[model samples]
Target: MSYTIPFPRTALLAALGVACLAAGGARADAVPAAQRPVGEVTMSVGPVTRTTAQGLPEMVRRGTPILPGDRLDTADGGHLHIRFIDGALVSIRPGSRMLVEDYKYDPQRVSASLVRFKLEYGVARAISGAAAEGARERFRLNTPLVAIGVRGTDFVVRAGELTTRAAVNQGAIVMAPFGADCTAQALGPCGSSSAKLLSADMGQLQVEFRPQLAQPEIKPLQGAVFATNSTPENGSTVVAARSVAAAPAPAAPALGRTDSERLATAALADGAVTAAISGQAAAPVPPPAVTPPPVVITPPPEPPPVVAVPEPTIPLPPPVLAWGRWAGVAAGDGDIALPRAEAADGRSVTVGNAQYNLYRASDGQTELARGLGSYQFALDKSAAQYSLAGSVSPATVEQGRLLLDFGNARFATDLRVANALTGAVGISGAGAIRGDGIFFDRSVAGQAIAGAAALDGKSAGYFFEKAVGAGTLSGITLWSRP
Candidate 1:
């Protein structure tokens, strides 16, 4: 079975009404319901405190509901995890302060869902939940110098004094400079400019904020050491110019005077000042010298090249997949294959644009019962597959499981299983389930399982599989309940 909680508009309005009355105002009914609790703390370790809108700080316990306007501060060793109603998981690392600025979730009503957070300091990891996937551009993370927009993936963000670093573990994120709307000459209303899109395969990026710089400097993060002093000016011009120019003709360092010479000069200037103050005659200073203009000499133009050079070669574009369709093959004995059957009605979930069909099967062949409905499958751009963690319904096969592995030219499936009583499990076999009607050249051996889960009462077998390879599975019945 599957379910979705509707947005509590009345409760939110009532809360606003109470707040307005407490503030000695009668316009509580005019307040919007956007500032409401959209999630709660599912896990907490050590001392995690939350400051309420009333300016009161309180310790956060497990299952504590978090609302908009709530400020969360974690102690040095404290950790916190917030699970939003839309299934997004946010893990707050130690010594971090975060604010749930605004959140709205209504799966049935896409326009009503939005999520936004502000990380004042410290680190936080966000796994895009159902709400984020559906809301798309409406989801964002605000930092000191930039605002990040998610694309249904897991990502880590670290906020610091000098820079903000974002690493995509899965999917991609777009980051734009904060308050970029105002003209560089005038700091006024906040606006947006072009954003930088970062992919997980490209590692991480560090956004360095500098004084007098209109835009933040973004560079590939090398290691733990962040380039704080690196700016656009230094990166493209100053540093490159210095590297290319010949070593300054071996001239003496500028202003290389001795301490004695400096002291004597200071003393003479002091004496002159004293004489001028006293209206008396002082030593006459030497007049400045006139600089001589250099005589110009014209040089002969270089002779034409003796030999003609061949034109440079233009590289060809990479080969693209045709993405044609193929019919399923019947499995002989010992061969693995999905049974030919229509998906059970009402047993599926849609996350973003992908819908998963849950199914239950016995011995990987005998269909038992299909799940009541489909569950959302959030796409992980980094892995190029749907995330299985925290999935509402995961397919079951024999004593093992069928896992999806998507890539550029192959759609591979792996059989993984574990003992329920002893907790012993391992991946038994893997192969390319579909491709360009050819044996997948890529090695399937040694491919690690992205994730796995046990088949429980709440677990269902069915999920929407988005094709990443040379084929399309888009809405096909990969697995389903009886």
Candidate 2:
């Protein structure tokens, strides 16, 4: 029933040629809950959901069941594994979310029997471990409206209500409707023979598909920006998505006075919502810095009435230590990998993996940093240089996790725009704000800023815990712009 083909030397080399990545890795995110596989509960929050032995991860909680949205996090080296009630495994990275509506496992045959996950925002890698190709126990994922038919292949989906981006890392993932008869839904040019589903150049909301398009960049029919170069067999076409997932924030938030919070808010601001589900909120703002008052000493009452005790001077909020949110970070990549970054001003710097000589953004001619560890410089209102050093602090929840010295922004760069950093407790990344936008470019030898990832209407929060199962997990390298 299966067939295989051998390739000639020329053909084989040609095939490998196209496989090379021009630059970037993948612009994606992952769901902490639904991304994990079941057999081994890789990650967990609480009682919300679990990756069943043969089930995909599910949305355990939303903001209070219906109020606010809950956020999950991961990094590059991290992934959220989910199990399909039928025995499927899904892996998600740092920035991802899923809304679960219905799922029933028929362990007898190992299938979704019936399964669905609404990828509201972020990225997800789904692998069908058990569901048979043509068997009725099909595994499927839905955006607001359109549906995706996930085969045994490994597919990572980045979705928004109007614009869903589906890229196949290993196998092909077909998009169809929920419960629609596979054969009955005779798509005109269904397979690779039909051509590319769309071109890579298609705008966010205006992607057109053709048979010639490459396999890896095949974005299914969920995003609002889809175009039909050719007609389908169905006389009347179904518009597909009920609504878009979310719109992308502009460029990175500018580094300035407004971005002092902690968490970085993204997603939610990009697409529209379809069904009701719980997910993470925007990154939260950092708690305002509380500087302890200077110690004051009172002199003992002297016998002489003329002798007066001197009062201690309370130093004003050290302009340098007056902490508040700086302007937003440039729209950064969910998979940012920057070398040493020079702060906005020529004199300041922020630390990174690589080393570099940076010219300050605030002043075009000044080279504020060079001979130092990976560091970025910033300028607030001063003639002083502050460095945002990157390092793992033993006393941090995000410890070992990459942390940015936000102070570098104000003192170094002249922000064109900015967003707020949200957080809770001592440190949290939740909430929404505005920003100039930022992103990473993998094309360069040392990955650098390719563009920006604006975070206008998202949020962040910190609920660090392992309530699900495995309490020991290496957080993902997802946001390690490090």
Q: By lDDT, who's the top model here?
A: 1
Q: With candidate 1 superimposed using the best TM-score fit, by how many Å does residue 294's alpha carbon deviate from the native?
A: 66
Candidate 2 local lDDT, 1-482, one digit each (tens): 11111222234233223221111224312423233222232343333342333444455422112111223333334445444334445554444556444443445655335455567655665655444343433555655423566544555555543234554434445553222222322321223211233322332221221111111233233321211122231112445668767987789967765563554565433322322233545444556799999999988886766767799888863111111112233212321122322123222221111112111122222222222122222211111111113321111122222222322321111112111211111211212111222212122121112111112101111111111111111011212122
The per-residue C-alpha lDDT of model 2 at residue 264 equals 54
lDDT value for model 2 = 0.31
lDDT of 1 at 282: 80
lDDT, candidates in the order shown:
0.48, 0.31
* Model 1: worst 10 consecutive residues (lDDT sum): 318-327
Clash number for every model? 26, 151
The candidate that wins on TM-score is 1
What's model 1's TM-score? 0.38
lDDT of 2 at 58: 50
CA displacement after TM-score superposition, residue 95 of candidate 2 (Å)? 3.0
Off by over 4 Å in 1: 1-36, 182-194, 203-218, 222-482
lDDT by residue (1-482, candidate 1, tens digit) is 11111113233223222211121245633656544456777678899999987788899987677777889999888988777767677877788899887777766896557677889877787878787787676777877656777777676777765456676657877765554242222211123433556766665554443211223445565444222222332123232344565666677668777878667544556658888899997877776698988989889999988997899999983211111111244222322222323222212111111122122222222121233122222221111122223322222232333333323222334332222222322323333322211111112222222111112212212222222222212121123222
